[model samples]
Target: APAPTPTSTPTSTPTPPSHAGRVLLPHPDFRLFLAIDPRHGEVSRAMRNRGVEIFLLPPSLHDPDLISSSSPSSLSSSASSVGNGTATTATTATTTTTPNTPNTSTPPPPFHEEVRLLASQGLFGSSRRLRAAVVAAHARLAAACVRVHKRPPDLRELAHFAQLASTLACRGWPALAALVVAWRQIYLRSLGLGGADMVVGLRVLAQMVREAGVGSTLGVAG
Candidate 1:
């Protein structure tokens, strides 16, 4: 009992601090407009997987309102004219005169021209919008690849932007996406994305091109 060793009380080890899991919200400054339909489910999933929030724009967004509001007097006159069969007479007159009028509806610019115009207008200024467009273009390319078994004609200009954006997005860097696009526009060459990133980006572009059978038309081969 002399030195009956004071029974040493075992001290409890301190528990390690617990860290709550972080919930990654979508980037706050960007908004993407996508149609809400089953057809776009794959693209929607891809955007979300990249931490982008999808905003479902109604199909109406694509349809501009062609009907202009009319005054009551105008409406009444229109109805009365229809009742008097004047509308039919007018249609007949238009049909008789139609052949003389030249076809004035201009075709839309080619897809590449559209892309160039959009880029020039600073439409791809934000990472979010750029990313959304890229996703769309990528979907188009994939579909073309499957259906035509080659790079579709429309995939050349559009798909290249998609490839650049996708490459940066995959690297977890959205900010760099716009930079790359700007570089391509101004310099007409791929941005020097360091050794590894450059290699990865080129590989991704090559794969996309190969799958779509776009070859040198994508403008990414250089």
Candidate 2:
């Protein structure tokens, strides 16, 4: 009798990772996620090589907080989302192949309920107090960055939280968001200052200040 022929095992190709609604990186030791949306695979790879600890995300899924979450999940879970870049971040990064489970944990409740709501309601009796609250909020947020990141929060993250806080207990979200965007533009185009670009930036800054100072409120948009 002829010896039975050996059988060969068939192999399946791996699926490419999807970035949408998934947490690609582990959150070192915090609740909020630092998300990125890398358009190219190389971009994600480069950041990972640098040990940036970022995850790939889709621009459309900008709002991590808005990601429909269920019961509390472990921080160790693969599900992730972004901070501050929720609305209009143009950056990108890598993603994981986790089953599409929504993020389980929500950020802590907004602190100082009075201050967060006072600015938007026109209840602030003095600019001094309003300015003080904003500054204090900024300081309050810096603690997280220093404790975890070992440095003061960068302008981008700082502004992100500032705008985030304004979305609730601080002031007008639009104005704060606009200010964050303006600052971003200024930071990006810092070289353009003392030139025509500076004029444009200044004009925009003035317009933003004027609108914010109007002491009017628009309902918070989702």
Candidate 3:
């Protein structure tokens, strides 16, 4: 018996859409707060060495939306007093003013909204037309975390990190969001958020990092 030959056709792999331009790493501070086993203290030190600050404040002292915008002149004066460490000053000077007047006029960005936007876009898009700037930023952050963190994290964990980033973004802390995206993608993968307990724990950690920044807190960890 003779077998007939079959013809094969070649097809192109579909490319993911490109993410549009958005603020990724807006230069806001990055904070990492979790109970560090003494073994991981080295990482904390490394983060500080790299100019990423660290803080160990108690939970009672938590607040993220307490930003107080300042007049450019007043900010400049305060920065000069702090000397040339402008990165440090930028945060302190920006958040130093007592908000004598609360800005109830404008509502802050919400978490769900950002999530909806993210879900609409494929988790990662093609090189040419990626998703939003934030997602692309997260991918970069995830890659960096793979290099730095003790264990590499997977896409699910990275997605959770994305959610946390969105939470920060809602708080007018887009830069913090970007940093979290990067750090989580880099470090928090295999660690696994675990079950509901881990979810609660991560929320706490996210808040800790958010306030550890200079704009919201009085100073940077340095």
Candidate lDDT values, in order? 0.34, 0.36, 0.36
Q: Choose 1 or 3, whichever is better by lDDT.
A: 3
Model 1 TM-score relative to the real fold: 0.20
TM-score list, all predictions: 0.20, 0.20, 0.22
lDDT score for candidate 2 against the true structure: 0.36
User: lDDT tens digits, residues 1-222, model 2?
Assistant: 999999999998987668546558867885544443221123456656756574433343343332222111211133233345563322222234233321112222233332333332232323422333333333333333333333443445434433443344333345445444534443324323344333433443443233223233333222
Residue 130, model 2: lDDT of 31
Q: Deviation in angstroms for 133 in model 1?
A: 12
Error of 3 at 31 (Å): 46
Query: In the order shown, what is each candidate's alpha-carbon RMSD?
Result: 19.4, 24.7, 24.4
Each model's number of backbone clashes?
1, 9, 12
Clashing pairs for predicted structure model 2, backbone only: 23-80, 37-92, 37-93, 38-92, 38-93, 56-94, 116-169, 116-170, 117-169
Better of 2 and 3 by TM-score: 3
Model 1 Cα shift for residue 214 (angstroms): 29
List candidate 1 stretches off by more than 4 Å.
1-155, 181-187, 190-222
